[model samples]
Target: MENVVPFKIQIISILATLGFMYFIVRQIIRGKLREEYSIVWFACTIVLLIFSFWRKGLEQISLALGVFYPPSLLFLLAIGAIVTFLVHLSIVNSKLQSQIKDLAHEVAFLKEKQLNESTIK
Candidate 1:
């Protein structure tokens, strides 16, 4: 015989999921969660919904998209992208620091030159 669960349990699970989604949305609206950060949560919700419902169509789409493990793969990709972006930002920061130092030296030299010229006059 196939295993069976009560309808009420399934309904409770669904309501719980909806409540969780509502909480996340409220946090997002209140600015506790940023838009970019929320992408991960939204993606997680989609993946969770698909797995919880055992949706064949979603599984097929995941397979077609070459995501062997949907949740893990998506998380890995997001982290990888964030790491790459941070690396890029570090490089930009170094360049800006060098420029700032150059500007500071130039300002100091100009001030010294002006002071010397005024003293001579």
Candidate 2:
């Protein structure tokens, strides 16, 4: 037997997905979220909306991917997305650290040169 989600649940899920999409858009409009970062959120929400509308499609995808349990597949995808996003953030953090270090060194050098010139004058 194919796993089936109740009609009420599907409606709720679709509403939640739309609510999430609205939140993302609002954030972008408010300048709290950048469009580049919002792409992933929008993509994920769209997938959720599609799945919510096509109830049995997830099962078909799960079976095609050799995942015996559809919910497990969903969990796997969510975890994967989280991990990927985290790694991206980590990379950005590293770059920012390097840039901060370089800026600090340049500031120190400029301060030392200014002090030397003032002492000579």
Candidate 3:
């Protein structure tokens, strides 16, 4: 019965991974998700699929990481992925903010120049 349970879990995991990959690909194809974002998701799903198919490898990694429970490793990986993604978003946001400020300054300068010319005329 215990062996059967693990096998069932493995099958379910594989199906779920496939479903996730399909969803990401569909979103990318429809242009709902950008390629850069989709790349991260695709990489995540592929890693999940690899661990799903290779239960032994997952177990070894968990043991190596000193995680007594293998499932906990999945949670750890997920949290790490979220943190990494948030950092990427922050970097992009910072760049956009800088560009917006520069553009605003340029517009203000141009408007001021135009006003000065009109007054002189």
Candidate 1: tens digits of C-alpha lDDT, residues 1-121: 1212245654665667677788889999999987775676676566555545653444465578887765555467568867876786699689999999999999999999999999999
Clashing pairs in 1: none
The runs of at least 3 residues in candidate 3 whose Cα sits more than 4 Å from the true structure, single-residue gaps closed, are 1-5, 107-121
lDDT of 3 at 91: 98
* lDDT agreement with native, every candidate: 0.69, 0.93, 0.86
Estimate TM-scores for all models.
Answer: 0.48, 0.86, 0.74
Global CA lDDT computed for model 2: 0.93
Q: Write out the backbone clash pairs for model 2.
A: none
Candidate with the larger TM-score of 2 and 3: 2
Q: For residue 93, give model 2's deviation from the true position in Å.
A: 0.8
Worst 10 residues of 1 by lDDT: 1-10
Give the lDDT of residue 101 in candidate 2.
100
> How far in Å is the alpha carbon of 87 misplaced in model 1?
0.7
Q: Which of the two, 1 or 2, has more TM-score?
A: 2
